[model samples]
Target: MTYAPMAVMQPTAHNRAAETPLPPHAQITYMERTSSELPVTEFFRIERPSFDPATGQARFFYRLNDLSFTETLQLPMGADAAMAVSPAFAKLLGLTGLVLGVSYFKLRAPFAIEAPEIALTDAERAFVIDVYENGLGEFYARNDLARFGKLSLVAPTDPVARQPALDLPDRTLLPIGGGKDSLVSVDLLTHTGVDFTPFAVNPKGPILTSVAAIGTAPLYVTRTLDPDMIRLGKEPGYYNGHVPSTAINSMIAALCALLYGYSQIVLSNERSASEGNVVFDGRETNHQYSKSLGFELLIADTLANATGGALKYFSLLRPYSEARIASLFTQSTKFDAVFSSCNRNFRLTGNDGPLWCGECPKCHFVFLIFAPFMKKERLLAIFGKNLLDEPKNEHSFRELAGLTGQKPWECVGEILEAAACFYTLTRHADWHEDAVVRAVKADLFAQYGEEKLQLAMAECLTDSRDHHIPPALAAKVAAYAV
Candidate 1:
């Protein structure tokens, strides 16, 4: 019932208003913080968010261990932005703030982030618990913390995600990550003549060039994190690891669909996301858990409950494996020069550096997946070097090829896809002698025989039925299947 004050004027915070005047909705009284030791805080409190519909900016506040931080999301708004705001819209905005609280919550790794400031129904509260538990699965495992997980955060709850009925447009909102997977989605949707808009948050670099290559402007959203939080993470005793970034983006995309009048938010998550990296603390920790189908279903159900069924979110690429998507990516060269799957380009702190670092697991996997379907020369040209020829990359490739340790905690693909690609490459005279390939070929072949490898690859290229894609859209997509 009471609101938390904003924290933009703190000495450590950057003055965002100097760049633009504070819209009346963004204007809030500033408060100073304690100048002493970090408090032994027990709760990661989610505060009431402040928003200005005129500009579509929402500032979310959170307090962790007595330290306050503010994060902002600038949604798409203008004359085309929805003017008729309702209680449902505000509720969705509140939920956005709630999910975003995970950013600061992980710092102290609090026992509870109950978020008394945000008005969530009992069902909504349970949804937040699942997000913190499963979404932070990797975080807990990496930090050696056992506080929050399956047995940790589950409260006895009932299922009650009410779908709200509203007259939303027939168009879709495609979230392009400027990768082969998303660009593949963009090409397929265009091939089938589906009306859609490209959307991204904090888009720059390849996200810009890749969409520019497609010759369409994406609905851009800017996300600003508090400088203090970044500064604190560098200081001693701050917990840091991965958070479910896609889950955070999904919330923003839903807001875009509502404000921009789109009915569906299409994602590029693949079937491989469902596979976990390793099982620790009796939990199967997945690197792409947020992108998995289970999380997609959770968001869909939560959006229905949050908006009363006004919006829909699902992955357009869910039915296909990473190899199938990679094969489809090679079908067109429209984004070949610009599209990159390298995680090096998207790091939070450092890499605004290379198009493809050509060494990380992401680069290795992308190169591996595309080799069977793309020309060796063309694939090498795209990456500026053959990742397979680099002997230093062999160990990591072994992990991806399912010949070594558990999948290197990255958003690469299912182990079989990597093995299948390696198996397919062994027969190619042009590629068979590459250093990494030669090193893994013997081990990879013995692990999966030729017949089994071929069958697995055939299945990778073929689409599966486990998806939520509409029958009509599925038919249209099938008509243009590569």
Candidate 2:
């Protein structure tokens, strides 16, 4: 459960020295039965290494055991591609990359789960692989092997057979963030006649404002991680880096569900959560590690084993795309002016900051998707500027059109939906004059062609319905398109 600091061994001409290693830790454990009642159990042992001067990387490895399946993950220090590692890691310890690749590889039998491909350049791939290999070794050294021994006894049991359902008050805990996804989730849950309280952790003004507008009871938690640990990171030390806020937030939701007797912890993550991060070491790891299906199943299994009852953690928005969710929000009276999916606005910084810095991929994608549903004038009122007018946004639009770059890291649907929305808007007279639309016409359709582009767009639109857009909202979507 604890790790000692490894002395920095300087790499010779061949072996590079790794940075200070953090205490060994277990990321998670799960014991569950498949729908077919096949018993499955797994645990992750994370060994994080000290920073390495040679590569200028922070590394960590995770060893996973699932009774039958074993996986070893080696993650290198810097983030490759656009998904930057957390700013906390950078500010505290000079961690680079906005997102880090958390690779998972089968160590035992080759488990055949289909994952998305890693999209990275050759140099980025080399850096990612190096970090991954070094990180894996550190995880092995730091983790406690003995704790895993207890997990063997835990097995998944049928929820209905184990205990009678609790007949407590019909209370629901609606998870709310400032994003459009969660707002859509809250609306759907409210429509379902569930009496609920809105839950948030360390939320800023924009999110709080949206939640307050919902008029639900608010439950908030003030998170305080050890500042000493953070300060230690500042002193040329090592850290696992900023785990996705969603991962930490999910853990908090699990605890809250357990303590408050809530039956379900509904997440707002979409199906695109499965899209892998940019590749390192010939593997496509999850950038939003905890949001992915693998992590969701792990957390659900853990909660079930601990409580021995029906406690659920599922994405209410799982089947939908960012576009469909935005479409639903635009059609809804509750969310039209208030909902925000922009990451920059969601930061601890105040709302007075740019509501939508149209440059980021998120802004570009959001603008693209919403353009089809809302007229130009109304859309500009909401976003404050015509995002489609910017030339940088035009390139991002073409990227979504499959003209440049691979799918972005945030969500695969972001790109897919943007492409679809672009195709849809081009068919309309209103959006034809829009400069970005014109660029997509000249740049994208010329290459991909209109027929192929339309087919792809239609496919994406069809795929959006399989997700958790409630019947009322789905109806609204249909009505809007009509």
Candidate 3:
């Protein structure tokens, strides 16, 4: 199903104030909740967002009732003169402001989102609606917002002219997560001789160190969140949980592509990211929804249309599963010491955290998935512990292998993909006796027979027909992933 992103949200006379520095707005004061315990937020509004071609600074404003919030980013780039003159920049900025609204909108989560300031086409309206509804699926499920009313987006606008496809530089900008998956892409792209630059919005220890091992200069951007937003999360009556972070990052990448003259925004999201974690109120929510193939296609098409194919977006590792990616990751040793997939280590505002926090689902899953593919000593040394041998981690493995409970609310593979790894471990002499392996063996086999497990393992090792990889890069992906 191709979603047509027609000339969207044509800006009107409102452009002058939007392009200029923001005028003073009301402060998003605390305690908007009424005495009845129900929030009084009836609507969420996207105020005009601004960008300065001189400094590459951008600001986004949003409001919930009388309260207003701001978010800003200082990009390490000068805005493109040509792109600034074109309609692409404004449209991209507007769309970006619309998507970034999720961060603040999730705070109050009112039923209505009104963008009367910017006029949007029907297609733009649909895109924004999806950004709020499906993009916030995990937030809704986690907060158990079933009793809350359905969400609506109102973007009354006249259609504007679409930008013709501009000729962007022939280069790839890869977002490094300081994980095994992105490192695999770095190795594969390097070996295949692709001209790409490692990019990150905010560099953390792991991401910086891992990129340093690649021995190349990486482009880094600085994004600053409103301190009030963080402070409010600690305040009473405020809602906080996961948001569609990848969606926000994707928009940022597109902006960088425009300003920095990069043509391709390469991601390393695997095939298994498409799976959702749970179903609530007849709605399925995926922790990795923004990283999934569906979101990939949507954003890819949106960029292709918005930038007129001047900028392209696709996950280079989309055809492979987490287990397969792990197998490929073991083939590279350059980032073994510095790479970390632990969620705790990738916090937005922290440093010097442990490379691996052994207790989390990310740690357990990464260790377990890699156990079947790597040597015991090497894999264990990287994580600084043998997660499978620990008795307490058995329950984490249990949920990952689908023996009990729902799929974890983390960036993990499908249940069968995890079960395949566990079953392969059960057959391995090195890992068969591990506490987690032994504990899950009976229930794992009972739920998925030996033959089925073997089939799942084989399937994960094979390629998927579903992906948005360009034809030129297809063989490289197959060679590296398989």
On lDDT, the candidate that comes out on top is 3
The TM-scores, one per candidate, come to 0.87, 0.61, 0.90
lDDT of 2 by residue, 109-227 (tens): 11122111222223323332333332232232222111111122111222331222322233556678776778877776666555667887777765777887888767665543333
The CA lDDT of each predicted structure is: 0.75, 0.48, 0.78
What does candidate 1's lDDT look like per residue over 110-205, in tens digits? Answer: 675655556666767767887788788788767766654422332333344453466678888888897899998998899888877888988867
Question: Of the pair 2 and 3, which is ahead by TM-score?
Answer: 3
lDDT of 3 by residue, 369-421 (tens): 89888999998788888888889888888888777666778998877778889
Worst 10 residues of 1 by lDDT: 8-17
Error of 1 at 93 (Å): 0.9
What residue pairs clash in candidate 3, if any at all? 119-157
User: Cα miss at 349, model 2 (Å)?
Assistant: 5.3
Scored by Cα lDDT, where does model 3 land?
0.78
